[model samples]
Target chain A: MNEDAVAGEKSLKGIAVYPGIVIGKAQLVDRSKVKIQYQYLVNTEHLNGEVGRFEEALRVVEKEIASLKNGMAEKVNDLSFILDSHLMILKDNMLRDSTIRAIRDEKINAEWALKKSLEKIRKVFEQIDDEYISNRISDVENVTERILRTLSGKAQQSLSEIDRRVIVVAHDLSPADTTELNLGRVMGFITDVGGRTSHTAIVAQALEIPAIVGLESATDVVADGDLLIVDGSTGVVVVNPDDRAIIYYQEKKLQLEDYRSSIARQSHLPALTPDGQRITVMANIEFLEEVTAVRNYGGEGIGLYRTEFLYLRSKGFPEEEDLFEDYREIAELMAPESVNIRTLDIGGDKFVSELEITKEMNPALGLRAIRFCLKRPEIFKTQLRAILRASVHGHIRLIFPMISGLQELLDAKDILEQVKMDLDRDHIPYNEKMEVGIMVEIPSAVVMAGVLARHVDFFSIGTNDLIQYSLAIDRVNEHVAHMYQPFDPALIRMIGRVVTAGRSEGIRVTLCGEMAGDPLCVPILLGLGLDALSMNARSMPLIKKIVRAMPMSQARDDLKEIMGLYTVHEVQQYLFERIGGMFPELREKGYL
Target chain B: MEMVRRLKIRNSLGLHARAAAKIVELADRYESELFLKKDGRQVDGSNILSILTLACPKGTDMEVRIIGEDSEQFMTELDALFQGKFGENK
Candidate 1:
């Protein structure tokens, strides 16, 4: 009940998309409760006046959209394209004429007529087969809703009007709704429906705001102006927390800020052990624009560029030229530092409808990554050719993802060789000496790392998948997610074996996974003799700070003891005790 | 003075909102009464909703009719848009 939550009785749990801690008053923007009443015009003489009223409402909505566009012009580059479409919809004579016609013929109020016009447009949009175009219906609905609100004389309630900083609790925020939020006055946001990859979540991350999404009853339980604690790191939302809980989180917030500032100060410094051993720290990026973040956080190079985004974001297969241009730009930007381009790792969570792959019983273990690429060589070759062509521009390295065995690795490389031969025949210039590598994410890959290492230049351990496959747990499934342990003895042993295997083959081994970014796991990974650590750009500075503070000799010694531990709990306990003392910041946050 | 030209939508996305907006923007610049006819259903070229109501996808053939003093010049410019695929490659 809202009463119990407001009385400081309970906390809600959700998915943590962006990490931070914030305490603020809750501002409920319940758009779903806004009901529009359909009213009919009683008099015939009011027809022209009704049409004029509708036009006036349209103008007001247009001005609102224009102001919104101007407000976000500097913050977001891609917003203009969406706003431009909204402007077109507002200026649409078809919408205007039809609404006026309906008002005259049906003797209805402007709101009802506008709704009718929107319905006609919605019907047309529904008939369209294209997914991208059909999605535009939301834009139309948003614009029309604004107009209807204006027609009904509802005063605009701007998020900017809040006198103090607040945490927005909403059913869900559209991209436009999220943009309208004044980031300065808003500390964070909690939504009832959305995932990490949603537009609102991405915008929240860009704004550096704490956000907890997919909390089904966030709006219902959290009352307006109730003091709320949003722990985005742990995905906990304490509605009207008790004094003690507030004080604790407040101290944690300060500690987090202090920790962040300390790491940021050490960002430009090299990631090195106290014993003066340099450990290369690179970034794993999904979008090309994130390179700026990578550079800002002091990543030496791109360790893994997830190329599946090219397919996921596209309506159909991305043309080779477009792919080439994007790759070339990133390569040119990071000139001397290598860009390890991972070939298309589609299927599973990242599916392209155009691929028309049948639904599998278990997508994670099904035909995906290297298997998907091998099955669709035409698509794979297009990406390979683009990467090969871009290789000449900078230090480019090709990495194959989800290689379960030596045969899959060889088959993928064979396709690459075929692509290279085609490029040679076509007189396309590329870096012939571009390094080829495989992601050691599969248990089989770890077992065959020595043989696989001999066939490649490097090994990047994708711990997220490796732990999932090794422990036989789907990380995304909440029921089994608790079993997905990174500190499991089996996972640690497998990773250690892969590191040794790469060393035996005289090749560098890197960890480009969630575990690599985790500060508590960094000492153990460094001790395991990992040549490099790659992670999200945001985590680079903190990891680097931890790595710089730790002595390689001590970590190596601690690793032997850690490996000897029999269970995940023992290994975790050992790491907590050891890493906690070394990094007091981690200790204060209880991360260790 | 009426000028008519038959053209095919070349852009893969057909005449979606953006493309329809382009046609309307260009059509509004002239004094001619521009009408777009597809499969016998004609709508005002200057109205995006009417243009969209035609539901013209890629490869759909349509007739553009302009009736006014500047009909010839208007037809020429409209033809250019069709040929250029409204500046959208995909």
Candidate 2:
């Protein structure tokens, strides 16, 4: 069995959107090959019948959509808007009337007429200048494709039906198609194209399904009913696995479930050390809808609410009221628990089409974050006005990102003050004492944290950016990503300086980067005296469990020993030994 | 009675999806035969696809024509919509 597995096993790598392991039979769904046969009617008398056929197809697709909506009604929230829009497209006169006209005038079959109508509409959409607006063409295509599939009698092959559990392999799954999947029978999904932030990925995470996207050729390579193993955490897909490999994955799958159940049991408990020192665990979110998940995972508050998504998702600048509504909902939902809103961290990796920011040789160091806001104060002020208006709804704290020095911090604060004055003059109620802070990500910010701390209420060390900037490594560049070490002696010492500065000035300091949620680094961060650890919502439970079992005093002693280590390897090994010795149960459970 | 109203699209995104949805929602309320004209191209007021095809970007001048018993009332409501910038402020 081992030799057979070694001889026949093939593995593929992709982006891990959700973490789980599953072994199941492969079910390939190739919607891209759904070809529409263009046929012409032989007689003029057939026009009425052809139109009727098209109408019937539309009705059938509408019913399918309604059932899809019904299937997700209680389990999913906020999906009705998208499903309703698809229903509207089904009833659209432009689509219906144009197809009817084509069938009557061109003497074409129902499928051909509908395709022609969709093609005409898609051509017009292509001419639109805005990328966000033009992207609507895909929605039109998705809807028309569904109707076309119904006309071709291929609609029933969608993931809505499966007598046995299978791993779905497809080119891509639309939001609507993803909702139609039978949760009980669908073990996981592997797609040819998608990233961690795509809508399909988000839905997969919400559904708690194991998914690996960007496989590039998973649909073409895997055949139906072939044995398959999907490890979403490692983004590895093994096809044609033998008995030994299947057994290995089955054991891993069980271990993952056990770990999840153990964490779920402790989710409601407070994150406290054995000595009774409390550590606040919060979630960093990019969308308001994630607040529910944060609450479910026992996040005390939203430590970092990224506001740039509102701008990037819109065709142009998001209106103040639209921004206000989003912030208000998040604030109202998490009242008494603080929601730290980071204002406009755009540039470098995130670019808005409307902004027309010229491509730079080094976007990471160029006009981004506070620099972009300072250059365009009106854009900055508009966001400030909306955030200020939302401040009165709940505990909302404003934090400026990428503040390289004191001037940028003061300038941003100055615009904020002006927005507040305008709101006050308009007789708008806002929290006058809303606390403001700056992210100490850049090395200069770390050097000048003492001065910056005096001006702001708190400091959040964005370790993701700090490590990149301090080490001069573009973490995204694969050639140098190996050099992006979080355990570097210089980086740890810099973090120590910032934490010390925040402590001496009597201001709370938080860590809200990828490093904060990492269980291996939690002790190091706690020993550095971080007031809060903000991470993804899913990571909070395990991190909290680890924090609750260890004493802060022991962690501090380990931190001292770690700081004395000369090399990154030495620090990591020493910390692992100490943490493993302290929690043998965790080590046995493969958590340490 | 027949009525016509000329207005400029003040919303930054022009007649995009949400804006078109709002227009269709409003137009569906009246029994009048409403049409929008921009650059000599006419589109049915209640049809989102036709409205989107017009590609009426921000600041584009458009004319709305209505012919029915309730044309005057429909014209008044549409005039308010235009004046309000379709409930979107720059």
Candidate 3:
């Protein structure tokens, strides 16, 4: 690195994605040396000494990797995927063979051969034009740095601690950087080469660090020992910020802190309307680790617990014992509190690693949720066994998704029975009286609800999918997504029918999708006879506040007044004015 | 003595770059010296191209039994890693 080259580089500015201020030394992630090493490796040698060199080089690389891993462990939330890469390279054959050949024929040293071999593979990735596949540059640089340092016999220096807050800027951070980072001491993160969806961003978000990514030369602009401020919410970073700017932002920071404490204080209080109506606030969890959020958020119980997370990091089926362990943990944590577990809703758009349910032209309409479960009775049975076994530990309800009709329901129920009988035969304990529920997403379920509701214990309307299917639009397809309206008359009518039918059968009716969490639809759903509202944990407190502000009678009346509206905009505006007109403070605060 | 876990490239594309990288990644995570074997011959599991060279096609089940401290977790993760099509493009 030349001093002139560093001086010639210009600064680039962009929005900061997280907030805080700190000044720290710089750690550059350089890979140019690896490129040079690659260019020099073209020869080969076949000798015991050459083989020994390769072995020695590998040991050095391994040690560097170990030291890096130790350095990054506490700072990162998840380093499994990153470490997994190193493991693969250490055992890689093509790289070893190519390097050995380069050593034997090209007459290159082990370090150069390794670099050259990695470059060739990296070039292949670059040609693919897929970021997901091509983003192995970080991994390559990490491995090269380790191997190079090892061969040079240089002891790795200990990373500096963040005694005061600081901003970390990098080309891209390895999992080691994440693990080794002292997040409490660091203020935020800004990276030049990582995507928002990349592992680096995921960790930064988990640590609640303000992070901005995809900047071209962020690391070059923010100098070592220069003061830097990160605004996480707006994704803004300021270099050597003025005092006035700092004072203004300091107030903003204080306000945010106040709001956070207010939200926390309200968690323990029941969400009710000024007029006495109560709203059920529940938590949605993807993993058992998130159960803590439910308690922290003061949620009533688990509304939706996605079971797919258990299968996410594994290749085959999760061990029945492991699955049982996780389920039991949740059940025990929420004992006497109901937790609704949805059956594995894989296939369609979601490709399960172990089971690739048929790829279809229309995944949302194809074999998924209930349909997939019915097709693979055994897979369904295993989950059902685990859920049923878990039920004995607490109050648990099993919900089937993507239900279109009676037969899918019947066949699924049949499998559930077989699982129960098997458990009984094996003398395994389970909650025999566990409630069964169905997500009314398919139009057929809505149309024949009166007949279908007779057999179910509860019906939860999954409005996100229901709206997409009802409009014949793909919610994920950006072009047509806007046309998928939850407030469409047809969707409203379907929801009305399902809720009415459920009440007639003496079955509880709930809305568990995104629609359940929306403040605008609260009164409309209550007017239509929805008995419960289940939504994500984050939105629970605010929705509860909305529910508590309105009287049931007033809500029903307001719904009746707005029901005759023909369009979503008309309905939205009418409700906004009616609700906001009464609560000016809430409306002014953007609570609507 | 080190043991090897040999899994053929069962994905549609012959151990495309990402899949190959994934295999290498998984092998390095544990204490084992993992290798991919083909027809009684073994190649380093950590090398991206050597694993791809085995050219194990879709539906081809390659054995990946390991011997190391984290062997069980390694083998289990390897199974998923191979099956994911290495975050395939398209």
Candidate 4:
């Protein structure tokens, strides 16, 4: 529950990332960036002392990286090489000599002089034309950012150490914060930033926790240990709910628990529509630990197995053995069913954006996903080799992310072929017939799906990016989030084109997006005749129940009527009216 | 000894961080001044960032100039490292 709303109840609103109701004491963690941005000038007498302070900070950072290296190497030896490179950067002469020169000659404090030197080096890095080599600018940025944090003497709060079950409220969780946070102790979370598909939001959905994000001021409003009621379904946070409101939520909580238990009992059943059409429902997961949850939630297999954690966990392009171990575990765990591994889907900006390195207006539009991988084929090859090596352990397929063009698709395949040839020469065993696919997210990819369909084994539609890119509205921005509509007539037609293209090529077309998990969007997906629907594991049972309840002919008929609708509101209203009439029992069961 | 040798950067990633680290580490062991000249721009061999700035891709022909007593020994080690592609087989 929330802030020091001690005397009276208050209401706050945000975009709901996950659907659930939870009442807990608020844990107001201060994840504020250190404000070491103050400026100072050293006197001529103190300039040497200022220079000495900078040297000491470098030593501190060096020691920190070394310790991280030693500790991480114990688990994965390949990680140490990445740190060795960082060490070399830390001790680079231009970085050290210039900072010293700035302190002595310019008569400024060490922090400011170091910042100046970093700016100079960044300028040099910016001039480089090679995008991959230019991206090394972030390595410089990270080393500088680490040193700045060291100088400020305010280390980040290790979120994994939180012991008590509570609602975590933060300004914005960095990629580090999102990955390392202790989910076992978290009851719910509310943040001042992030959209429905943001890193933190995806984590919350995968773990099925109650979370609300983009509150704009939750950090300013919520106080520690205050009684707060978070309704993730309604995107409402009540600070210190009154007795009457408590009674209402208490009853609703019981109903949720009841519905959850009932769903778990039937989640294992195959989803067959009334017209005898079977749909494969899989789960999108980031961590290997989430494999168990997919099995429990009746997921047929893993779809969109995001490989972001594999690289981030080890702090670099992870070792092939480590990647192989993880992929093999998931493949073996989900034996008969296939696991679709989506390769690294991040960009250079993810590491630098939060650190304030460069002013990239839109990280989404910048170099990311397939573009990033293709630029640095060394990193891409590592993951491809791991996936290929792990294919023999169990049923595994490969899916590349953000394929905006046919060339990117072909280039990725060429790398895959090269890796396979390397493995063949080395006598390493792998599934030679492993299915390869591409995520149809970018608008250009959808328009050219017909041409691209000739090459790939399957297509997994990533609707989150499709909606944002096509609509030209940033979902994270609350101002334009209202425009992030799933039922827009344009999207329906685009999806129809993709489905027809896939059908003509005789390849399975599935969806692995947030839309697949949504109850209201289920009929629309069914109408498109998608072969498989993958989503958050928790959403599977309800989706299956809906699939069993409605006939495909009915959904197709409903789709035909909605396809002619001009606006998002009209389409949503029509679906709501149709659902209310067709599935009256779902409403009674609290499923509608 | 004073000598100059031309060598090709053979690694898939070019003169990247780890490769540069090997060159820097080798240069530090001998009392020699080693410099790599690529495309008319030369950088100190003992400095990692300088080597990175050179940005020599996999097939770039780099000119190495050395001066001092241990120049011969330094050349032998640098040649071995470059030929082995800094042991990066990925």
Candidate 5:
């Protein structure tokens, strides 16, 4: 087998978690610890004063921990427990006692004493022979980072202090490091080393940050203040980009930024085609904080709320109250706006230890989402009960995920009925009239949409998974990720089948995956008769802008003409030439 | 000395809750006032509010603190929780 050769030169590439091009000089975020020996050498003449210095360092460490915890809690809900643990470690009496002893007995400095004790902790973790335990070494590293920064008297100036919008070039960044970056000022990231699942990469994706990692010598190649062009979607970073390329990119970036504002202005407006057809645009969110997107970004309501995130977090099942309160909060927030909650799409990549939902031989096709929920009827009922209970607070619609065929649909309905019976028997108040829907993810569901449509209130096509399952490809698999095409005629035909099926039965049809948010696929989805489009709030404005610019009849005709042709590349090119300037940001991001 | 209390993970996403609540729960079970630490930072376990601030991810090992009375027992149980994958279902 011929192995692909690694690029030896300095290069930068990472998944475009966030989209935007930023070019500026390299501002290295120094998270490294200071040398302990240097501290001892400086303080050798004043052994008595070293204690006071150590005490001051300890105080600074404690203060930083408190501030860090407080800051993190403001953005994310409950991660401070780890910070408390770190505070205790920084103040650990045993570690402190031993370090103090070492300082006097071995003539070692405070940093060395701490480092020496930390070595023992690493050893203990190493003996456990587990990655989870072993990774705690970072905790030590984090504390050291604080202590060293304090010692160096430069603890307060973090990555965020880089006051200009520029490409962030680093050797590698930790999750904490990535979180601290001022997203507005930071245009892109170029790291020397990191994989797709690295904390830096994951955070970048969630923030919609344009990043490129795993490029060796990226720091050296891109000097401080060098003009660089980062293509996050393609994991490409052009250092000192040519003048012509810079001019092209600068114009493209401006157009994209302008389009975003324009979209923001029209967020509240109905997505009306030139021919006067209206389509509902909804938002997809993973957390409660994102609820504001509905009003701020012009979403009718949440199209899909992946409930598995709730299940993955708890040690056991989320209490009925837990699910109830969560759903209720989301519903009440949206109030008049509709919220479609997708029941526990756990299993596969999403796992919960208490669920006892074992990984299968093929997790993608195995017991997951609706299949897993159906297997454990009691669990499904608990969720259904919570969703139905919350329905009274808002216009809530429930959707089931990964329905392969009609049987699964029937089984889900059966469970929903059982939940209704349990609630009725208990005289629990719930919205009995709330509509139910199914996610058309599997090819089997897409093919039998007509039959499946009859059982559900609506059809929200999950195009991300549908395309993956249809092509037998994983969008994350670098080698085959290219194979994961959104506009493939096969997928277009599949979506067409579901849309036609839903329309035939008077069922509302929507697309709630990344594809729906895509400008290229927007016109096609409209032409195929999709009732609504739901996606990230960020994409809502632009999608609405594009939809409003086109006539429904013209869009339909154009989609028909394009679909008749063959090849993914052709489909992309046609969309590029047709919808080019309307979605300049999408074009700048190289979605074309 | 060690004091131990059984606490179920209440936060969504178990140990990985935005504040690393499980780690905090383990640390709070002692008089020395345990801390579940990551990097060089310490999160007080007994402080529900404090622990919820750590943001440790799922399957992450949190540093446990056992300061005063019943420190030994709390340490043992906390160690077991980490060893047992925080009772994570397979």
Candidate 6:
């Protein structure tokens, strides 16, 4: 009744990663094809003034970037060289001369002239075949966008300028950008690119802001200030909705809101089945910013603290202190709660820090994770030292990623022991008995789980990589994505074995992957005897709601029944049918 | 005085932003008018973006020209930079 929806409506469907509904104004943050509201010629009288306006905007941007570079330069070095190139782009005479020429000779406004210069430069860049060099245009485009924003006095695209709540429309919101939207002005998200498991969806769900991802064209279609009805529950986004759609959704919003609050009230309670079996629900976070969201979602501890953001965000090698500051902050925030810090799992092809002369042939199988760390012990020790130092702050645990065999596991542990001795001799205090764990994601590791379990304190099954390696399918390749099945009986059998291995060794085992977050996969995971399930914090409540309803005694039997069926389709069907019968609410129109 | 030199881009990344910025920074010191030519296309050697548009990858052959009172001195240092691979070998 309160929110009004206009006419000329169009609806778009996408994978709804989070559940909620909101109607708000749209704010487009697509920096690629910047939208300019004005493009008019300047009068002869104001021609000089316009040129001066352009010059002043350039100066302001120069100072803005210069100060930013200086600020980051204090804590880190060498990375400034990356930001320094932006300064060069901003001050490049090619852009300056062409823009000023267009302003004076063509009699155009500064914004129009700047855009014209940008288009010309882009044209020149488009001819280049090198993907890396062609990609550098984004850097130049970013600088030009800043200049345009400054010229129009709208330089504050930092989202704080928005007074009213608006849904952000973007190409893709990275982990950093997702957390930065903690701004109260932003209500929801509609991104053109992202999967159901992206950090944006996880953050949106954890923050209770509904999100719809993989819309493919939301950024291009939604204009600034256009009325948007974002229904994350139904996985539908209605653009410029009419009156009937608004009234219908308004009531649906109220009912869903009531249902979510009821779930939230009991989310913090222990996740125990009627048969008295308990499971620990934890959050898998990559940045310090998500720690509060983890706790707010009733996550008991950090299940997987992915440390790749340090390398990814900087687009260069981050220093030890940079790693320490992030690890320390997350540890302090989640004090008394065990934070499992997984050492860097990023591949070298994506790594920008090393002066890569030639990219790897196949990075996923090439020098990555524990393999790369073993080769570059200095890079490895840098992270190990930081993690060890931060372990003094909270209940921190170290988990090595992609350990294919006992040799890699023992070799990585040898380096960790060496780092501890180095720290101890220097009188640096660390947890003398910091727990160590390995990701039981590799098929070999699963086969040798009994041998692998004896050496580590815990086993965290990384299903994302586990399914990929075991099934031998690239998870992102659309042609075989359906083949990358989570319910593949082989993987279920492997997880059952890993849990069995952990129990034999008297150590706890957890599942920390997308499967851990999936509602359809929860009962099977419970029946397999996993001690904990660490997933996107947003999925905790939904998973808990399912766990709270079913008794573990029945789930163990359900697992045994489904395990008898070998094919993915049969197992998936059996689980879905079981879930439907248990909670008929899940059968309501793509509710799963 | 005018001077010209032919050089090979020894750096593996070619004329990327950092490498081009190095050339631009070196050009800033000399009074010479500097220009770079590759495959019949010439660009202002001191403009980073202009130099980048050349898109010379590693092993590409290019020519450098300097015209001013500082031409010879600029040529000497430019040759050193070319041979040094813009200090990126590390």
Q: Give me the TM-scores for chain A across all models, comma-separated.
A: 0.78, 0.74, 0.71, 0.78, 0.78, 0.83
Tell me the spans in candidate 4 whose CA falls farther than 4 Å from its real position. A1-9, A33-163, A348-359, A580-592, B1-90
Q: What is the total number of backbone clashes in candidate 2?
A: 0
Question: How well does each candidate reproduce the native contacts, as fnat?
Answer: 0.40, 0.34, 0.49, 0.46, 0.00, 0.63
Q: State how far residue A38 of model 2 sits from its true place (Å).
A: 5.5
Which residue pairs in candidate 1 collide?
Answer: none
Estimate, for each residue in A528-548, the C-alpha lDDT of model 2 and write its tens digit: 888999987877998898899
DockQ of each: 0.43, 0.49, 0.26, 0.48, 0.08, 0.50
lDDT of 6 by residue, A138-186 (tens): 8888789888777766545443334667898887776535433434667
The lDDT of each candidate is: 0.80, 0.81, 0.66, 0.81, 0.70, 0.81
DockQ-based ranking: 6, 2, 4, 1, 3, 5
Error of 2 at A514 (Å): 2.4
What is the C-alpha lDDT profile of model 5 across A1-592, one tens digit per residue?
Answer: 1101222233356555445665555555545524345345345455545555667888988987788777664423324555766786676554555666666666666677667766765565565433443455666677766776676555554433346455778887754454455556666677776544434554464456677766767766766556677756566676666556666556656765675576588778789988899999998876676777567988888998877656654435777887899999999999798999999887765544445554477777778888888888878888999999998999999999999888888888987888899889999889988999999999988888999888888999998789889988855444565577887989998888888899899999999887887777777888888888988777787788888988889778988888777999898888887888665656644655
In candidate 3, stretches whose alpha carbon ends up further than 4 angstroms from where it belongs are A1-85, A91-93, A96-250, A348-350, A356-362, A472-489, A582-592, B1-52, B55-90
Real contacts retained, model 6: 0.63
lDDT over C-alpha atoms for residue A197 of model 4: 78
TM-score of B chain for each model? Answer: 0.97, 0.94, 0.73, 0.96, 0.60, 0.96
TM-score of each: 0.79, 0.77, 0.67, 0.71, 0.72, 0.77
Off by over 4 Å in 5: A1-57, A72-77, A93-116, A129-160, A163-256, A308-322, A347-368, A371-382, A406-411, A581-592, B1-90
Cα RMSDs, all models: 5.2, 5.4, 9.5, 6.8, 8.2, 6.2
Better of 3 and 5 by DockQ: 3
Looking at model 2 chain A, report the run of 10 residues with the lowest lDDT sum. A1-10
